[model samples]
Target: MLKERVINETVPIQKIYDEEIMKAHFSSETLPSVPLVYKIQPGSNQARKNLTPTLPSSSSFDIPDAYQSTNSDETFLIYDKLVSCKKRVLIFASPK
Candidate 1:
């Protein structure tokens, strides 16, 4: 049986001020200046000639027989049972 690991585990909650830190770092005085003028260059014919369009050799969607499960109802029933059991345990542990 798979144990309820979440009940046993302790998750460390972190207080992050990422947005505030980013805003301070990217303030006007520290920000990079953009160039007023720009230059453009034409693509070389040799670079274009070296490139080729590619298509998948075999475009197929196939599912193996082993992967297809016939016990979906049983799977869902087990999941439902586990969820209910966990809820009961939590309610029992909590003080009203």
Candidate 2:
């Protein structure tokens, strides 16, 4: 499994779900309209790292995973926000 971290300034959830941001990953044909979103509580679970590669002698390793407003209607249509850190994750909405 891959691991990512989210930190720094917290952004409002609404802005994170913008269409322009999601368009590349989800075309209208692929994304569900008004997908469900569950708010995850900020806690230690987020702190859990499955694996962190040991660095030789790095001073700073503060970068966190991409923080995203996730879709949670038992669907794959995921909308996340990443500015400059352009790595993207695509989730296709599940069929009901």
Judged by lDDT, which candidate is best? 2
lDDT of 1 by residue, 5-61 (tens): 112222211111222334456657654452111111112222232342344343232
lDDT of 2 by residue, 7-91 (tens): 2223343344343336547777766754433343233135343233355353333332432232332534454334345454444
Error of 1 at 2 (Å): 39
In model 2, which runs have C-alpha deviations exceeding 4 angstroms? Answer: 1-6, 19-25, 33-35, 39-96
TM-score of each: 0.15, 0.25
Return the number of clashes found in candidate 1.
0
All models: lDDT? 0.25, 0.38
Worst 10 residues of 1 by lDDT: 34-43
What does the lDDT read for residue 26 in candidate 1? 66
